[model samples]
Target: MTFFQILAVVLTATAFFAYLNYRFLRLPMVIGVMVLALATSLIVIGLDGFGLSLADGAARLIAEIDFDDTLLHAMLGPLLFAGALFVNLDDLLAQKWTILLFATVGVALSILLVGLMLFHLAGALGLDIPWTWCLVFGALISPTDPIAVLGILRKLGVSKRLETKFTGESLFNDGVGVVAFLILLEIVAGGDAGAIHVASLFVVEVGGGVALGLVLGLAVYWLLKRVDNYQVEILLSLALITGGYAVSEMLHLSAPIFAVVSGLLIGNVGRRYAMSEHSREHLDTFWELVDETLNALLFVLIGVEVLVLNYPTGALPLGVSAIVVVLLARFVGIGFLVGLLRARRRFSPHSVTILTWGGLRGGISVALALSLPPNPWRDYLVTITYIVVSFSIIAQGLTIGPLIARANADSSNPTSD
Candidate 1:
């Protein structure tokens, strides 16, 4: 099958499975779609492994769908932008110290920690991955995808402050994570870079993107103030995410961070000055719908793209092992930092724990996996990443509800959800 044909199949299958989940299983829609997709991949491949008729021409057809390109290059920019554009600025500003610290310093620390361990771990598993590449994976996976987690959190309905902390941290940290990936990628490729060079790179990527985002956001807000028409303003915001992101990419800026800064600019700074109360309400509803629709498509893409990733049955054990390590590393990083952040006693222990667990990896991991140079080890990396992210969104994302419920039960039992 051709690329478009394969994409069509993936989308249609995702929709069908999503409907089934919506109708019967009644699971988290995104998680359900992924669960169904993984099931389908296993069944089809398993049938083939057994020498069944389903094996004929199926694997080849599935192979044509590039999970990497479809997710990272295509889906991630828009998803991140859509998620960030309507966030609460005051809440975010309150936790700015915490979020900024975690996003920048915390992400770097986690990446180094995970990379050192994975470097040794991969060698133990007899995998020949370079140290730089391990760090590449570390940087990519370290930043939490607030898109998936916030979706799950919204359903769970926790405290307003905790929700803001999760959203704010996730937004900024994703940017830090992406910048870290680029820095490591440069180092891996033998670019003329050192600590000073990396520091300079950080300022340009993060600072420059923030400047551009603020300018664009101010422009959008200024435009919105002139016209009370909600429809036009909404279109302009959409254009901001898509066109703004493309322009940032063309300028060689960080798209993830740019999307984030732009979102914050429009959501926070511009929000007070530009939008009328009605327009704010309108934009929020509009962006919420945009977020909802894109989320479904991204999750469905995750499910359908499983058929597209390459590997053999022999690697399944390795895939499971990689999942274990990523989970272990994430637990270590989040758990350690949660204690540090809450030691100031501003955030509740319960709120902090839920946020830690809510750090579900999603589109960014898929994107970075696809962004890898196509090499012999690329497929293994993809398999490992898919397994880790899937486990995060499905297992951790779904279980976050129970955790939050218990937290609430202990603190504010009488507070109506």
Candidate 2:
């Protein structure tokens, strides 16, 4: 399919599925669309089982979508920027230590735990996967997807403090996760990834991305201050997202981080001092639509992604096991940090439980898995990643609201606990 054809089909399907969701499903928009799309894919698969050719066509269409490139390269920048934009920087700063530990050390811990557990689990399940490949899987899966988290948070009225923790960690950790995935992938692919080299990679990617983001953000803020036109200011923000992301990629920096940093600045400092009231309002409305539209399409893409996945022998069982693996790692990672922070700070009842379950994995993990080099274990990794993500989005995404409500209730009435 040509680019426009692909766009048309995606938009048409998104609109149709969204209508169905609005009409009957009444689930969250992104989750509802995904569920419907997955159901459609399954229906196609069922028809193919009876000697029909629908599966072939469906797979072909899905294959053409290029899930990894379409998401990580094209859609991610704007999505991340939109998410980070409206985040209250003051709240985020208050949880700086928590976000820092969760984004960096917490992610590292989850990667280690998940990798080790999966390596052993794969062995027990008779899958001959190496430890490094398992670590690569961990690297991809450890970070909670910001796109998914932010979308769900919009619907669930969680506390500002907790929401900040969730949003802040998700926004930053994906960049850290991507960097780790690259380092491990290098070692797995026979690159000379020495300790020094690995550290240098992190420094260059993370540091450079942060530096570039601040520079671009400040530049945009300075320019927006001089401009009184809302249209011009909006266009400049768009330029910052598109141009800054591309430049970050060309320089081998972390584009995800670049988007987050730039968005935070533009939404906070720029909104306060740089942009006029009319421009701020227009900018917020524009980015909110961008976030909602892209999120819907992204989930729809994820739903149909099931059609093209190659499930190897024993992959089903292994994938089921991986869901447990990821959850346990998430729990431990968040629990450890929450435990430490409680000594110095206050937390809601079941804060750890909410944080663990709230860590929804979405397109980023699947995109990273799909981007893996074609090797013996790539299919296994991809299948498991899909399974884990599917469960995260559909199961955990649906129930997080109740969990927060319960936590809120308990916090309000201590005697109830």
Candidate 3:
């Protein structure tokens, strides 16, 4: 399919499902679109079973678009930038210690625990995935997608404090997670690097990305300070995202990290001092629309991409088991961090539970899984990732609102924490 044809189909499907969601489902827009698309995909599969060949054509269309390349290279910068743009910098700063801990140490802990547990589980289930590959899955899935988490939290009415924690951790951890994934991928691909070498690479990728982002952000902020026109400022913002991300990739740095840092700077500093009121309003509205539209299309693609996966029946149990394993790993990771923080600072009641359950895996996880180098274990990993991400986004995502409500209730009770 031509790019225009593909874009037309995606936009048409997104609009139809979004309307369906608005009119009837009334679920979160991204989740609703995904559910509808998944149902459509299943129907295609069923039709294929009946020898209709519809599934084949659908799969071909899906294959025509490279999911990993499209998301990681093209979509991610805008998505991350939009999410970070509107974040309250004051709230983020207030929660800096906790956010830093969760984004770095907590992510590391989750990766290790998930990797170990998945490795053992696969062995017990008669699967032959190596520990390293399991670690790759761990690295990919550990980071709660900022795009998904922030979107859901926007509608859930969670406490500002808790929402800050969720959003802040998600914003940074995905970059950290991607760095870890690349490191593990190297090891899996027989890089034969020692611990010191791997650690050095991590430092370079992460540190370089951060430095580049700060420079880009400050430069853009300076330029915006001299501009009064909303049109000009908006164009600058676009250039910041596209140009900054491209430079990060060329420098072999973490593009997501660059996006997050630059976004934070632009959304906060630029909006505060650089942009006129009119410009600020226009910028905010523009990014909000970008975030929403991209989210709709991304989730729809995620759901439809299921048609292209090869799900061996034998891996069904492994996929189911992976869901539990991921949740447990999240529980352990969040529980440990919350416990340690509680001694020094109080958290909202059930913060651990809320954080664990709210740790959503979305397009980022699927993209990473799909990007895995082709191997005997790749299909299994992708299947398990799809199951876990689908359940995470659809099930846990749907229920997180109530969980937040309960947490709020618990916080209001004097007898509770």
Candidate 4:
């Protein structure tokens, strides 16, 4: 399919599935669209058993879409910026220490734990996957997708403090996770970089992204302050997303991090100080629409992507087991940090449980897995990544609402605690 044809098909599917979700399914729009798309893919696969060519055709089209490039290069900056824009800057600052630790150290810890566990599991199951590749999976899967987390949190209306932690961590860890994934992937491909060199590269990418975002954000803020016209200001914001991300990419920095940081600055500082009331409202509405539309398309693409993945002989068991392993690693990795933080400060009841389950994976993980160079282990990793992401979005995403409610109830009821 040509690029335009592919766009038409995806847009049509997204619109139809979105209407169905709103009309009957009544689930969160992102999750509902994905569920419907996934169902359609499954039906196609089932029909393929009877000599139908629908599955093959669908797979061909999906393969042409270049999921990683479409997502990472094309969609991610706007989505990340939008997600960060509405966050309460004050609340985020209040939890700055928590977010920093979890986004950095916590992500590293989760990667290590997940890699080691999966390595042992693969060996026991007679799989020959190497440890480096397992770590790559770990790196990709460790961070929560802000797009998924923010959408659900808005509906659930969790406590401000807790929501900030989730929002802040999700927004920041994505860049960290991507950086880690690249480093590990290089190692897996026989790169000969030494430890100090690796550390310097990591610092440059992550820290430099944040620095670049600050510079871009402040420059935009100055521009917004001088302009009374909302349209121009909004266009400037768009430029920040496109130009800033492109610049980051060219400089080999973390574009995802750059997006989030600039977004937070504009959303909070610029919104408060630079823009008129009219401009603020218009800007928010514009970005919100962008966020919703892009998110719907992303989830739908994820749903249909299953048609293209090659499931290996033990894929079912390995993928299923991966779900458990990821959950366990999340608990062990971040739970310890939450526990230590609790000693120094108060945390909500069952904070670990909330954080673990609330860390929903989305397109980012799948994109990273799909970006892997073809190797013997690629299919299995991608298959399991899809399974884990599916369960995270569909199962964990749906139930986290109730979990938050119950936690709130327990918090309010002193007797329960």
State the lDDT of candidate 4 residue by residue for 145-252, as single tens digits: 755555566676666777788888989999999999999988887885699978999999989999999999999999999998989999999999999999999999
Answer with 1 or 3, whichever has the higher TM-score: 3
lDDT of 2 by residue, 212-293 (tens): 9999999999999998998999899999999999999999999999999999999999989987788889989999999999
With candidate 2 superimposed using the best TM-score fit, by how many Å does residue 284's alpha carbon deviate from the native?
0.7
lDDT of each model, Cα atoms only?
0.73, 0.90, 0.89, 0.90
Query: Which residue ranges in model 4 land beyond 4 Å of their true spot?
Result: 149-152, 409-417
State the displacement of the C-alpha of residue 385, model 3, in Å, after optimal TM-score superposition: 0.3
Report the Cα RMSD per candidate.
Answer: 3.0, 1.9, 1.8, 1.9
Candidate 3 similarity to native, TM-score: 0.96
Task: State the displacement of the C-alpha of residue 238, model 3, in Å, after optimal TM-score superposition.
Answer: 0.6
The digit string of per-residue lDDT tens for model 3 on 173-216 reads 98999999999998888895798898899899989988998999
Estimate the TM-score for candidate 1: 0.89
* C-alpha TM-scores of all predictions: 0.89, 0.96, 0.96, 0.96
lDDT of model number 2? 0.90
For 1-417, candidate 1 gives per-residue lDDT tens digits of 666787687668867887898998888777887788778767876886677857446556655656556655566666677667667777777777777776777787778877777777778777767887778878877878666566656666655666776777787887788888888888877896778999998888888788778888778878877887778877888888778787877887777777887877777755567767887788888877767666777776676557667774445666677666666676666667666776673656464456557778887777777788866667777777787788888888778877877877788541121
